[model samples]
Target: MTDFETLGAFYLGKRYDMPSRARRDDYVLYDAKDLTTHAVIIGMTGSGKTGLGVGLLEEALIDKVPVIAVDPKGDLGNLALRFPALGASDFRPWVDPQQATNAGMTADQFAAQQADLWKNGLAGWGQDGARIQRYHDAADITIYTPGSTAGRPLSLLKAFDAPPAAVRDDAEALQERVNATTTSLLALLGIDADPISSREHILVANLLHHAWREGRSLDLAGLIGGIQSPPFTTVGVMPLDTVFPPKDRMTLAMQLNNLLAAPGFQTWMQGEPLDTATLLYDPNGKPRGSVISIAHLNDAERMFFMTLLLSDILAWVRTQPGTGSLRAILYIDELFGYMPPVTNPPSKVLLLTLLKQARAFGLGVVLATQNPVDLDYRGLSNTGTWFIGRLQTERDKMRVMEGLEGVSGGQPFDKGAMEQTIAGLGKRVFLLHSVHEPAPITFETRWTLSYLAGPMTREQIRSVTALAPAPAPTAALASAPALSTAATGGGFASLDARAAVAPVLPPDVPQYFLPPTRDGALLYNPVVLGLADVSFANAKLGVTEQRRVILMSSVDDGPIALEWDAAERVELEPSALEQRPHDGAAFGALPPVATKARNY
Candidate 1:
């Protein structure tokens, strides 16, 4: 028998006897490794589904197993609400003041009551503040909101980044990613395109496949340009223009461009890049439970982001060495439309792929849903465990039984007994069925360490993540070779005295000198330059503007590189940059800070 106290075994709950209506002393210890085959949770709204899911995540984090949770309903943000103190003060800030008024009690009194209730509930389940503290110490928890800044905003800018070598080398995997990415992008533009029939889909997929094959990356602008004039003359047997005419391609490009130019769409490109490695682990290599809250995004935006994320995750998984033990968990709070029966959305392809191949990489996927009928039973065949909670209708019960039987693999499945067990399930009770166990176990869910404050509002999320680190800075010259006077023991005296030739820079350092707007002898003074094109717009206020600023700063011998605070912003167009300096330019002496490309 597995010990419930072991790190690899998750202490879900004690076994329950439906006939006696009593809980047994023998605790149900679920081996974490069994999750390699994946799991599913199905129940009604009031059947404690969220509580069970949250508890499962809490256990995974406590065991130092990293988790990436996709939360469409916003409840997963509660993972950050764990309070080891379990005091009234710990619960006060999250309690609804209106609830206190409804109960004819003061806010403080309500908080105190809630705290006492949690304490008693945990004690009843053989848990306390000590276990909560252990969970807090085990992993770092963060809530990432994709299209909102209330929580940590996730940027999709890296979505167009080139795939790793492993994925690029595998033709099937490469094409799968290309297809999903193209389909998702089109879907975001309100276009439901068929991969084979739609000219728009074929053009985009060809562009992506061509670029990714050569290890080249394409931003939205580059992709738009490619759509106008493709790099390849032929997409297949026919010429590119014959397959997708210029005018038609331009129409597709304009729709995507409009979405890119939307005032609200900028938020999608702002914050941390959607990197699976960063989401699963912190910079220090510690496990982290990253809750991606996408409740704020629209259906199209959600599908786009989810498809890109899953594609990135699949790519990342391919790069990792194979492992048998569970290395990480990918939990989706809702698996409704993303993996439906008949429809083949962009997300469905990646989900099915993960379900089939991710086990070898030790990536366990756990999907939960209230609407079991919306799910595809073919995908469920890969799942090894099922947590069946209370259902509201007999039809739902029948569907769940059918799914269970389909994945049973010739095991003796008694449908009547299973249906009877599921019908008897009450609130907070679940029937645990796993291929690793000979018999399905009926168990009650334990108390969750997080307070179920319901779906959090934007303001609430902001309050929760107020102390997160600021966004990273944008520095272009950081990759340039460092040139310092300290190393050379002299300034650019030769160039300063000659005043006729440009100073020689390393071949790796890219130089783009602006064309002289005014008629004069050009004096090419060495200064670190930074440029940014910013767009400001508000539909409600009817304001829209685009501005470009060029900031130049003289480098010094100080420890810090170019001080942007002291930089001068000049009105200049970045488009006028030339490959070489003016012919008759006089070179100025470069500073120590200007020697390195990183200073810019």
Candidate 2:
């Protein structure tokens, strides 16, 4: 019998109640206390990485841990729609997991178990009927008869407060001109308003925060006018109202932007809020559930939201009382465009730092990337847990293998077997390894939530909040805001600076850091840091008690007569004989780490 088994768990539309005969490919138990070190999930496209990431979070939230799922692809909004019906189903016949043997379980037994799980309403996981609202318009589409040729489009603009509709369809002119105009407008707007840039996000945030401060409502044009020039304007595309149709759609969007621009009406939210934890919790007396930044904005706007929140979240966390206790997790899916700009490596570095020590402060980060090459060697090495799934390329598999110390750093490395096994692993069965556990356990992720996550369409994203017209600037764009850290006022900017701080030493340095890595990879092997000297000749023949010097003792000890020789420097780990702290460690105990399981 396997030491770890769970046969009675329910699954999609079925249930199972095996009696402690759970197969090796079910799920691995992670002692929550051990999770403080943090984790990583790496796999190729369609390998169920996203599903697995959500599963862990589903469990964690039940465990009462706050979490942040960064959906650069804008899929996490489903969480808002993840209702109780998720995973709660009993409508189908029970069946055993794939290919159970008679001893494993007869078909009848499998059916019983399946029935049991489904009957318990522990069916699949997550909200089975979770919804992904493509666009606000899609959800609340109000049909408007072209009121007239001169002004129907213009009237629509008034509804959304879009710039007075300039394009006019002539009953006399060629139809081609009218069609071309509409096409140009849609193409320019990119059909949907997702993928916003870092700049645009801040603009929205800043506008809201600023308006919120003024205590008065200002519409889109009013806000845009405020940010018309230079730096702030350069961050993202300025023309948001074109899609909103100031005249055609509805005025509520325009009114809401101003209200959001105004501090009081805009949910009383201020600044960009992103971080592994706070995104999960409502801060400053706010609701802690979720913020569905409707994907109605353009790509630049969408990207802006991602970057601003990330930067802001880091800033917010710093405001928390202390280090070594951040308990938050970030779920990043389809993580590419949102990574640090291709020109900047620091962005990757910034994310890795967040992963390394999130545990101390009670933070956990999960990255689900389709492109395996994006996983960094240094970052992945620091993760406490790793879920690696199937891959298409030998090179990508090799990249993952490099994360294994035995294979990458010239220590009895086995590239072929590891690579072959990983490259061929079945779908949804991930190779799970973590700092707290040595053996690379394989399991099908516990299905805790319905898989409603899918790519977004351009039209679907535009329906949420439409862009508000920029307010014409009557005064210098608000003063450049100075961000103060938590020690002072608790704002998002301050938290970011602190989160971005890098460690000063390496993991094996024997220094006490929540996460051992400070900045770059440690250049030394740690095993030697605590070794005691055992040279027989160094025993001194017990002559030390008598204070007598032997001929051999002086061979190298005498400063006056011995000839000096130089030896080539071989890399050696620091040891107790030399590495002991002048002032000993406060705790005087080894750091928490998982023991290596000797066998697979």
lDDT against the true structure, each candidate? 0.83, 0.38
The positional error of residue 358 in candidate 2, measured at the CA in angstroms, is: 4.0
Model 2 local distance difference test score: 0.38
| Candidate 2 residue lDDT tens string, 1-600 | 222222221121111112332334333555555455666667777787766665565445544455565555555543322333322232112222343364487666655554444334333322222311211111111110111111001011111111111111222121222222222222223342222333333344344334433333233333333333211323335553443222322233233334333443232122221232334543332213232332334554444344434433443444455445335556666556444324332235346556654555555566677676665556555566667777778787766776775223333545666665575576676776655554455566555442333533333223211321122222222442332221101112222223111112212222312222233321111111122343333355653332222111011113323222221222233331332111111111111221111110
Query: Ten-residue segment with the worst summed lDDT in candidate 1?
Result: 482-491
Q: Tell me the spans in candidate 2 whose CA falls farther than 4 Å from its real position.
A: 1-22, 25-27, 33-35, 80-278, 283-299, 323-326, 340-342, 345-349, 356-359, 405-413, 451-600
Among these predictions, the greatest lDDT belongs to 1
TM-score of each: 0.80, 0.43
User: Which candidate gets the maximum TM-score versus the true structure?
Assistant: 1
Q: List runs of model 1 lying over 4 Å from the truth.
A: 1-3, 468-600
Model 2 TM-score is 0.43
